[model samples]
Target: MTFADLALGEPVLKALREIGYETPSAIQAATIPPLLAGRDVVGLAQTGTGKTAAFALPIIDRLDLSQKAPQALVLAPTRELALQVCEAFEKYAGHLKNVHVLPVYGGQGYGVQLSALRRGVHIVVGTPGRIIDHLEKGTLDLSELKYLVLDEADEMLKMGFAEDVETILAETPETKQVALFSATMPAAIRRMSKQYLHDPEEITVKGKTQTSANVPQRYLVVQWQQKMDALTRILEVENFDGMIVFGRTRSITEEIAEKLRARGYSAAAINGDVAQPQREKTVNQLKSGKLDILVATDVAARGLDVERISHVVNYDIPTDSESYVHRIGRTGRAGRSGDAISFVTPRERGLVKMIERATRQEMTQMSLPSVDEVNETRLSRFDDRITAALGDSERIDRFRDIVAHYVRNNDVPEVDVAAALAIVAQGDTPLLLEPDAEPEAPRERRERTDRDRGDRPDRGDRPERRAPREGLATYRIAVGKRHRVEPRQIVGALANEGGLRRDDFGAIQIMPAFSLVELPANLSRETLDRLSDTRISGQLIELRPDAGRPQRRTDGERKPYRDDRGPNRPSFRDGGDRKPRYKRGDG
Candidate 1:
C-alpha cells in the first residue's frame, strides 16, 4: 500500500518521496495505521523490510517538535543498531526543524552522552545496558516519554538483555504507547507483551520461508578464536565475484575489513561512523569491481543494492533471525544464487535453531577446512592467475633465449629450468593452516568414563604434553581491574567485535585499568582496527601489543589474589587494602 495511506504528515511524505519509497512493505502497511491511532503494536517482520520506518514514520507524525524532552524512546540490542535507528529518525524528521535525535549506547563516552541528554532531544535510541545506566543516573528523563519502541525485540532477548529490557519498560511511563517488533515471537516475548503492552495490534509478515532455496546457507560450528581462519578458508575455496561480511558492530565491520585487506583481499568497511560521502564511495567501489569485499554491519549495509555480491559471510552470528535475513539478503539478489556462511560457537546453537525455525530453512552443516584443503585452494588460484597472465604475453622468444643460455652454461635440461621457475613462483610459507582441534566429547561420556575409571589406566601412564604455541602477538587495552571488565567481556567483544574466537586468543590477562589480550601473529589489520575503536565501559579501548609489563607478584602488597570463592566474596574493591578474605572463595 502507499505510504500516504499510513496517515503520515506531509513533511514525512515529502521525505519518503525524496528517498524513493513509494509503497510500504507488508509489515509497515499493517502496523502503521493502528500505531498512528495511538494503539500498541506487536510487529513481526523479517529484516530489510522497512520495519524501522513502520514505527519511525508514525512516531514522527505524533511527535511535537516544539516540545523536545525525549518524547520517544527506541531501544535496540546493539550500538550499531541504535545508531542506525537514530539515522532513520533523522532522515524522516529532516523537514521538522528543531527536532533532535540522540543515540546512547555502551562504548561511547558517558560525558558526551550526558551533555546531549542535558541539552534535551526529541527522541532517544539506545542499547539496554547504557539506557539503564542513564536511567539510574537520572540523566535521562523519560517522564514525558510518549512512545516506547523495542526494535529487534527477539535480538535483545537472545543477547541476554531481556531482563534489562523488562526493567527499562517498567521504568517508562505506564501511560506511554509501546511498540515491539521482532522477526519471531517466542513464548517469553509474548509473555512480555501481555505484561507490558495494552490491547496491542499484532502484525506478522512471513519471511522468505525457504532461506536456502535459491541461496546456499551453511554453518561452520567452531570456537570463537577460529572464526577468521574459517572465513579465510571459505573465501579461498568459494568461487565468489563479490562478497559482503556481516559483523555485529561497526568496530567489528572495520576490524574484519582491515584483517581481510592485510591478508591480501580487496576489502573495505561501511558503517554509521563513516560519513555519508565515504559510505557511498565504499559501496560504489564494491559495485564497480574496485573492491572485492565489503565488510559491514547490518545498518551500514541497509538499502545497499549491489547485484554483484555473490557471497555473504556472517563473521559473527546475528543477534536474531531478522538480522540474519537482512544480512544474507545482500546476496542472492537479481535472480542470482548466493552463499551465506555462518560461524557458530557451541553455546550459540540455540540461536542457530531459532534462526532456522524463523526463516523456515535448515542450514547445512559443513566441516571445517583442513590445512591441506586451504593450501590446495591457494595454490590452484595462484596457478590460474599465472597461467592467465602468461597467455597474453609475447615473451616466449625472450624466455626461450634465457632458457637456452641457462641450459648451455649450467648443462641443465629445459625441463629443469621450467621446474626452477615453478619453484620460484610457489613462494615461501605456502598458505599452510593448522588443523583445528577435535570437538570435545559429550559430558555424559566423560562422566561415564570417570565412573568406569577402575578399568582404565592412570594419568601417569599418558604421554608427555605438546609444547605451547609460539609466535603469538599479545596486545594490551586501557581497561583493567578498575573498570570491572571481565575476561568474558574481553572475549565476547573480541569475538563479536574483532571477529576472533576463543581459540583465536592465546592468553588474556585483565588487570585493573588495563588488559593484555593475545591473538595470532597473522591477525588481519581489519580486526586490529576494530579492537582499537571498540568501546568497553563507554571508553575507547586502546589496544596495542603488550611490551611485557612487569607481572604482579602474588605475595606482594598489590591487591590480594581473590580465589575462586563462593558468594561471600565482594565483587568490587574499595580504596582500603582490607582484602576481605572469603571463607569459601570467589567463583
Candidate 2:
C-alpha cells in the first residue's frame, strides 16, 4: 500500500512524495502501523527489501523534535549500515522543521558527532562499538529515547558484538519502543527479543529471492585468507568487459577497489558514506566504460543497474541467500549472459548450498586458477594483442620508424627492442607472477566434526584419533545436563552465531552443572566478554577461563568429539577503512 495511506505525518509524507516513494514494501506495510502505535517489532528481511524505510519512517513520525537528546537510537553492525540508516532518516525528515538526524560511527572524528550530540539530535544512528563508547563516556543519553532499533541484529551477533549491543539496550528506557530487524533470526537474537520487546509484532518478508536464469553461476572454494589471491588469479585470465566486485563491508569494498586501481585496473568504490554526487559520478563512469570494475557494498549498490556490467564477483559471500541472488541479478539483465562467481570458504559451504537451493540451480565448482595458468593466459593475450597491433600497422608508420631507430641506435636485437616496448606497454604490473609468487594460503582452519554424534561409537566403545588442540583455551560454560542441551545444539549454536568454524572449536565436555568448550586462546577480550552472553537451550552462559585439564570420564568414556569428530569443516566467515578520527569520550 501507499506510504500516504499509512497515516504518516504531513512532513514525512511531504518528504516521501519529494523522494518519490509511492508504495511500501510488505515488511514496511506490516511494521509501520504497529510501530506507530508504540508496539515493539521483530522484522525479518534481507537487503534491498525497503526495511530501512520501514523502521525509519515510523521512527521519524514518533520523534519528538522538541526534545532532541537522541529521542530515537538505531544500532547497526557496520559504519556503512549506520550511515545508510542515518541517510534514510535525513531524507524522510527533510521537510520537518527542527528535526535533526545524526550518524555516529567509528573513524569519523569525534568533534562532529560530539558537536551534533551537544546541540541535540532527534535520531542517532551508530555502530555498536562507537555507541557503547559514547554511552560509557556519558556523552550519549537514552533516558528520553522513545524508539530503539537494532538494524541487522543478526550481523552484530555474528561479529561478536552481542555484549556491546545488549549493554546499549540495557541503558535505554524500558518504556522505549524497540524495533529489531534482521535477515535471519538466530536463537541468540530471538532470546534478545524475548527479553526486551514487549509483545512485539513479528514480520517476515520472503520476496522474489531468485537469480536470473541467464546468469551462469559458479563458485570457487578458497581459504578465507586466500580470497584476495584467488580473485587476483581469476581477474588475470577471466575475460569480461565490465565487472563489479561485491564486498560485505564498505571498508573492504573500498580497499579492494583501491588496491585494484593501484595495480592499474579501472576500479572505483560506491558506499553509503560517499556523497550522492560522487556516487552518481562513479555509476556514470562504470556505465560509460571509464571504470571497468565497481567494488561496492550491497546497500550502496541498490538501484545500480548498468547493462555494461558483464560479471559479478562475490568477494564476500552474502549473509542471506536472497542477497546473493540480488547481487548476481545485477548482471544477466534483458537477455544478456553474465557470469556470477562466488568465493566460498569451507566453513561457508552450508551458505553456498542454501544459495543454490534458493536460486534453484547448482553452481559449478571452480578451482582457483594457478599462477602459472594466469601467466600462460597473459602470454596468450599478449600474443593476440601484438597480432592485432600488426593488423592495424598500416596507419602506424611513424611508430614503426621510431621503433626501428631505437633498435639501431641501441644496437639491440629487434626482439629485445620489441620486448622493451611490450614492458612499457604493460605498465608497472608484472606480466606474470612466479609460480611460487602466489600469496601463502591462510593456516588451514580446523572444522567442527561433531554436529552429529548420534551415529558415533560410544566414547568407551571406540579408540579413535583425537583432533589437534594446540593453542586452545579451555572455557567453562554454565549450561549442561540440567539444561537438556545436546552436544550438537551447543556446536551448532557456537558455530553459527559465534562465527567460528567447526574446526575452530575443540573438544566439548558436558557435565552436570557446566560444560567445557575449547576455543582459540588468541580470541580477543571483547569476544571472550561476549561469550558470557551466549545461551544454549535458553540457559545463560557464565563463561570463565579454565586452567585445569578436561575432566576424564571414570567409565573410560572419552568425549564424543575426540573419538567421533571427523575431518575439519570449511571456514567461510563472510568476512572492512579509517574514517577521520573523532574525540573519544572513551565510551
Q: What would the C-alpha RMSD of candidate 2 be, to one decimal place?
A: 11.2
Best by TM-score: 1
In order, candidate lDDTs are: 0.75, 0.75
Candidate 1 regions with alpha-carbon error over 4 angstroms: 46-48, 158-163, 207-242, 246-265, 269-290, 296-310, 314-326, 332-587
TM-score between candidate 2 and the true structure: 0.54
TM-score of each: 0.56, 0.54
lDDT of 1 by residue, 157-216 (tens): 655466678878988899999999987899989999999999999998874544636688
Quality of model 2 by C-alpha lDDT: 0.75
